[model samples]
Target: MTTPTAKRWEIVDLIANRTVTAGEYKPSIKDYLSELTVKPLTGIPVALAVLYAFWSIFSSFAGALVTDGFMVKLFDNYWLPWIQNVWPNPDSVLYFLFVGDPLADNCFEAFGMLTSGLFVSIGVVLPAIFIFYLMMTILEDSGYLPRLAVLMDGLFHKIGLHGYAIVPAILGLGCNVPAVTATRNLETKKQRFIMMVLLAVFIPCGAQLGIMLDVIPETVGWVMLYLIIGFCLFGFILGKLIPGGNPEILIDIPPYRRPALQNICKKLWVKTKGFFINAIPFVLLGILFVNVLYLLGVIQALADLFAPLFVTWFGVPKETVGPLIAAFLRKDLAVAQLSTIAMTPYQMITAVVLISIYFPCVATFVVMLKEGVKELAAAVGVLAVIVFLYGGLIHLIGILLGVA
Candidate 1:
């Protein structure tokens, strides 16, 4: 072990590193500094969060106007028709294989404006992500996010978490990656693991919420409310069931103040850009995968298998199976797929609930790997079982209550 003097020196070096990189961050670990809260301001942070959510809703509306009015008109009507004219029967087999021609009765459809993942992302996901990042960065910087551990202590206790467990669940809404990173704030390995598991299973992000609205329009709010309740109730139940060390409530409450505009802008730009860079590729690939699977008649096979389940139990169409499967790859795309099928309000509510509780998502799955292979497997198995069980339970209750 290093001598006390050396540890002090090492910590000083670390603080210097943080101050330089984070600009506003001060990560001193000295006894006096350790006692001080890192968060220096607050009210603005919470206001910013509220603003960000609504702002995203507004911006997405504006984006929809632009994409629908200009892009859709230009690409779908003008460009696609010109392409079809030039191709004139586009009857070639290989062409039909890759790009389905409805005219030729080929199953696959070509990558067109209608199926352009990029267009959809621009119209829907980008605005929501940007707003989400802006809100989250403020919460994180102001230190209220840390204080949330304190605020939610009582609530979490009702859920099964020692106060420390609340941190990951809240952060999970911003992004599961950082939420997993924030799990380090938990006091012990067990607390972090359980919290991580819960977050991956129940917490719904704003982006997910946005897509859910578009996919199943009739009962989005009710679905969201139910999902939140499910998250809280199940989390409480699991926390109590698990035999682990009691979680203590210890957080640094930073003073409240107005958020810095410059800081918010800078962080928002970086985060939104980073999100687009990472997610755009995955979305395009998902689109391509769906197209190929549909081309090969694979989607139909699975749809047939699940038609009864979707129509009878969940109250959605068999066609919803593809989107539900896409959810295992990306929740946004899965939700987007829901838009094409018809369903009642009850089905819409159940669909969103099932989607919210269904999977940890691909990104979440990767984060679970950090817990080690065996631990990740156990975590996934438990999550998978719980999601379906809870979904089925909700459906049964709905039926009994005449929810449909």
Candidate 2:
């Protein structure tokens, strides 16, 4: 027996009749706000306000209330002293590695696996990342992120990314490991590579941001300004250079809703737990590794060897070599190490910016590698070029301003 096949229009009409229903739609406040957030006229100012609030809350709660107000005092006054006094033989290798400088009064200068490591990871970074994740969770759960992405689509396309590229960029601010993975959401290999390279080089993780605020609050703004400029400039250049299809953005904008407390707490817990498991060990190990390098005279030799280039080209002290090494493991640790170095404010700014742009932390590197080895190599090559060119450009600007 032969079955009769419905015509294409008839099939579509049958499906529509069975699945679609007509109803009177009434727009609510949520609809109005969603439209407002995606429109250029209203969205830009709202975005600015949202970002300003995010920064203010981040700096105030994490930097001021928690780290500066609580954790710093506890670690510096109590923990450092107790560990220093109890640990045997201040000159002993173990003591130096574990407890750091016995005479050092603060945790920041202690530079031990236990002292500075714990302080940097817990005291500074923990609070910063906790608050960051909390706010990020709220933004995500409330359905603001996609709308923000829509609003940013136009600018993102200028750099060869769609609006959704903001997902990885924002996530990169927390940790580039996840951000590197988040790039998988992009449509093209070119988009993923550019986003990975840009985030790895320019977006300072929350841990690093916390340390920057604590260590170089005066010049952190300058460092961020340089980073932003580099991100846009290099992103634009790479977009044009890399052969790829720059497809138009297609995204679903969900209606804004009240974020659930349960979901927010769960996400916060997951992210915080990941940070504790992954980041703390790296911070501690980075301190230990750098200390061992110092003991073996590797750092000193590197400083001496690189002094000419650092002084002339980068216009910063070569002592930055130590922090650069630490930066490979954990950038927050690197920034903490940088704080102990003696440099002028401009030099400090330059060194911090260099540390940020020089390379991704080991975790980020691993994730990028997971994406593709050839891509990783290409990204690294691009990174090397950026470091030399952008670092020199910054130095030239500083020289013109008589600051370098």
Q: Could you estimate the TM-score for every candidate?
A: 0.75, 0.96
**Runs in model 2 lying further than 4 Å from the true structure:** 1-24
Q: Give the local distance difference test score of model 1.
A: 0.64
What lDDT is reached at residue 209 by model 1? Answer: 59
* Model 2 C-alpha lDDT per residue in residues 79-170, reported as the tens digit of each score: 99999988878999999898888889999998999999999999999999999999999999999999999999999999999999999999
Candidate 2, position 68, lDDT = 89
- Number of the top lDDT candidate: 2
**Predicted candidate 1 versus true structure: per-residue lDDT over 1-404, tens digit per residue:** 78999999999999998787644655444323323322224434543564466545544553454444465566455644555566545665434433335352111124422334554565456655766676667766765565555545666667555655666666666567667877777776666767777777777765665555444545766876787777777676666776677556776566545679899899888777767776666666776677677778899999998788767766666887787777766677777666556776776677767776777667777877876788687777878777667777777877888876
TM-score of 1: 0.75
In model 2, which range of ten residues has the least summed lDDT? Answer: 1-10
| Number of the top TM-score candidate | 2
Worst 10 residues of 1 by lDDT: 104-113
Error of 1 at 183 (Å): 2.0
